[model samples]
Target chain A: MKNPYQDLPATAYWRTAVADPDALDITGLWQPKFPITMTDQTATSGSCFAQHISRAMQNHGFRWMDCEPAPPVLSPESAKTFNYGVFSFRTGNIYTTTLLRQWVRWALEEEVPDSEHWERDGRVFDPLRPQIEPGGFSSVEEMHGARAVTLAAIREALVSSDVFVFTLGLTESWRNSETGLVYSNCPGTIGGEFDAARHVFANDTYPEVYAAMADVIEMAKVVNPAIRFLLTVSPVPLTATASGQHVLAATTYSKSTLRAVAGDLANAFPNVDYFPSYEIITAVPYQGRFFEPNLRSVRPEGVAHVMSQFFAGLRSVGVEVHTEDQQQTPTAPPRRVPTEEETADDVVCEDEILEYYNAH
Target chain B: MPTDDHRFALIGDSNSAGIGRVARSRGIPFLGGPLSNGITLDGDFFDVEDGDFLPRVDGPQAAGFTGLFKAGLPILSTVGFNTQRIAQELHHGFYRPRGLDHSALSDNVLRQAIEDYKPGTVKFYRAAVEEGCDVYAVYSPQRFPEPWMALALRLERLLSGMLVEMGVSLVDVRPETTDEAGRLRPEFFTERENDQTHASDVWSAMVLDRFLDDAGIGVMA
Candidate 1:
């Protein structure tokens, strides 16, 4: 009997396939089982890195889908301040697989996280997305009204889009155990009052995380049989950790667990695909230059590199998508998040609140 | 980072602007510095006994006159109007003066003014945060007569509560300026109608003093 390695192409070996991890041409590293054409309506969500996918698609000449576009009255700058056009919908930073599942369930009316609104000085804040509204919603009724629009947008994306790309960021999160509701950030850190007895800290185990990822795919597939899922894990590190472990250890565990989940999903489901945007930026070959001084934020060139590989992979298959569309726009240079974007990180990290409290 | 540059900012309705006007009129430097007076939270309208919502600023503002609102201090204004309302009014064009003593002779033209003002209110306050300024929203008592008082109270709730939600400290100057009858003192307004409300210089100086004591940092000395 012939061993499986005998017939495989030289591309399988470290010597041939990955000759120099440092100068590795990452093109063709990812190929989807189900092709995502340029014409497909694509929806993007998850961590801050996911914004790159949406933006890249916009500049790369794909028909990037936006269900709830910003009103023309708002400038692109101001519109982004309130999270308009950041993703397919306005559900700011889905952040985790669990939160993604939670949003899906809410949109499908499968589960309703209690009608919980945290109030400060009479302004109402939705705990699910504390900063979605800058000064909180004017009233609980207004909060609900805006929430209704988001839920609708979410449902539209889930059941209708041809491609759904999610970039999972963390495993640790705080939840109200009694209500079985996961909050956007730990209460008291940003807006809600911290209640020791009521709020519970959770660092989700692999099985828990994997189940969420798998279940959402199954659930969404049922709703829209044609929907395809593409997954990426954010390369950003954890900002702060509530677990007793050191933040470095916590970030490693979180990212690794999420990566495992993405890998597993890609292996299990034919329709689900995993892209190596994570590997291209985080791998040793690049010498970590893709990251900024904080060693967290991905340099703009890093995003540009990831998209280069993304389009390159498709081009190999004779797909006239990524390149054909780019001819018209010639793809603008990567709009990297500079160190000055310390504030833009708000959508990605509430850990800054801890830093603020400690400094004060 | 230089410690001297940590900035503080003021944002709110015309009342906050009024205090700035008052300080400039008196020939005193802007009043947000070191504390001198004993911290006396005389008539703070905040009902901390019920729930603590506002940021911890010394609540002496409106200290003496908490009694004027015998029925209840108008925390009702805490729920007052937001930029959304202003935006809506802009879309619809001029809001009729209603019981406000100001004439709406050019209601349409007045509405055109929304094109300039609503974003001003929202953007400036947001700037206080963007520029990392320590925000102290000084709310002077700009009272209105009977029927209009209810609407004015709601507007107050909206504006003050907005600042508080955005994590700004409050200095309710009502205790110093409001008459027992729920109207601005006869002099704060440029005219008896209370339409063109402007605060006096002395009133501005007192507010700045209270703010300095609350913030515990001021450059003007």
Candidate 2:
């Protein structure tokens, strides 16, 4: 029983990994991403890792596309607080792959209607950015308006992106029972009470997750038809768990599943590539010096190494790929919610989606 | 020798809850006050409703609004888009009241909240608890509300007693701020000439001073 994916020659995960635009660069494949100059405009999303990569790339003079930088503007104490600027004019923690794509489509103007409360009202109320000061906003409606402005800014970014990098974070998610919407956080933790009726459990298997990743590729194609995808697995662990398992184990299961799915999707989509940021930081024999005291944030020195390899690989292989002309770009239509009829054939099985990468 | 987790909760109207700026050259320090322990504030939002006597909690339009109290109470009335919309309409810088029954709704809200989390005032009274705080406190800054500026002091004393019996430690500053006229001194409202319900910096500091002295928690003048 041989795995067909294992038997095939690995492809270059970098833009210039191939010496000739047609050559392969597997050694450089799946290494951590370091921002490099590409004529292609890029959009970054996913977990905390994506945030770092986006910042590093922006520093490298590569355009990271999203209008709202993480902290908006660096404060006087920004040196102390380590400001990343306001990410999406809102907060930039793309909790799921679906959210990452939603942000991308929204940025590209391919989507206008938000996931109702999720992108609009739901973003400002994100527990990650606590309102320590009063006199800022007294009502949630005011907060909702603030979030709408943020989404508007993110939507502006997607209009002219060429490369979209997404880091898949988790498989387990809490989906709203009625709307079938997935929440980044469970009820009672950040938002409100956890009503079993309002939210149900969904821990996507490898196939389901892979299919979702492919769907994101398809959606990005719909937006630019020529957009390239670079997928990575988040190295961070789950902060807490509702999977009835220990937090550490839950994190492992989530990451491994997401990693496999990323790999599977990459094999299927010629334009899609997977970067092994998770493997380099966590599994590779790094001599136990990669993680911080909290076992969460990666050491800056380690990140610099991961990034160095990424840049070196790109610089060494100078392969030029065709970039879509900005002027000739087709005007994408406003995003509409998929009707039940449109999503009818969307009842895809878990394995059907994974069949590309897991070929026997 | 404190061992049990003595839980302390704050329950009351916006003023007592300390909604405004706490610290400024002339204002009260919101973060550094006695109310600084695990304070979670959920402000009410106003809906499109027309009423005066404060409709029942289940009444139309009133029920659509998200809050525990009714009547254009200081906290509930000044919420959502209604606050700004009203300000634009009135042009007088006054908050309009879409009044609803405050007492009944407050009772139901507290009762429901306690039933869900057994650590607040309900647990303090219903169970013969000794350790861990079931005892809570509520603040009401708008107790003296606008127009009836004359009854501010009387209202403060009335609210203090009611809140204290419900296991909430009351911070009543009306007695000290009241003038010889026995009316709430005008200086209490922050934006005095406009919206007279919200507390001013001077009044908030006075409230903080009394809170520290009464609780004997820390060193503050």
Best by lDDT: 1
In order, the Cα lDDT scores of the candidates are 0.63, 0.46
Q: Please, what are the lDDT tens digits per residue for candidate 1 over residues B46-135?
A: 232222122223423223222211212111111112223333332322223121122211122222232233444434344344444455
Instruction: List residue ranges in candidate 1 displaced over 4 A.
Output: A21-24, A322-360, B1-221
Cα RMSD, model 2: 22.2
Model 1 in CAPRI terms: which quality? incorrect
Could you give candidate 2's per-residue lDDT for residues B177-199 as a string of tens digits? 66665544666655633343445
Encode model 2's per-residue lDDT on A1-360: one tens digit a residue.
886655554342233334334321224543323333456577776676777777666556555675443211112233123222424234446667655555445455566633433222433243222221112233345444444544555554444566777788887777666665556666556554667767777777787777667766776576567677778888888888778989988898899899888887777777777777776678534544678988888888757666655555566566232232322333323333444522331222111222211326
Q: After superposition, how far is residue B147 of candidate 2 from its true place, in Å?
A: 37
Evaluate residue A214 in candidate 1 and report its C-alpha lDDT on the 0 to 100 scale: 89
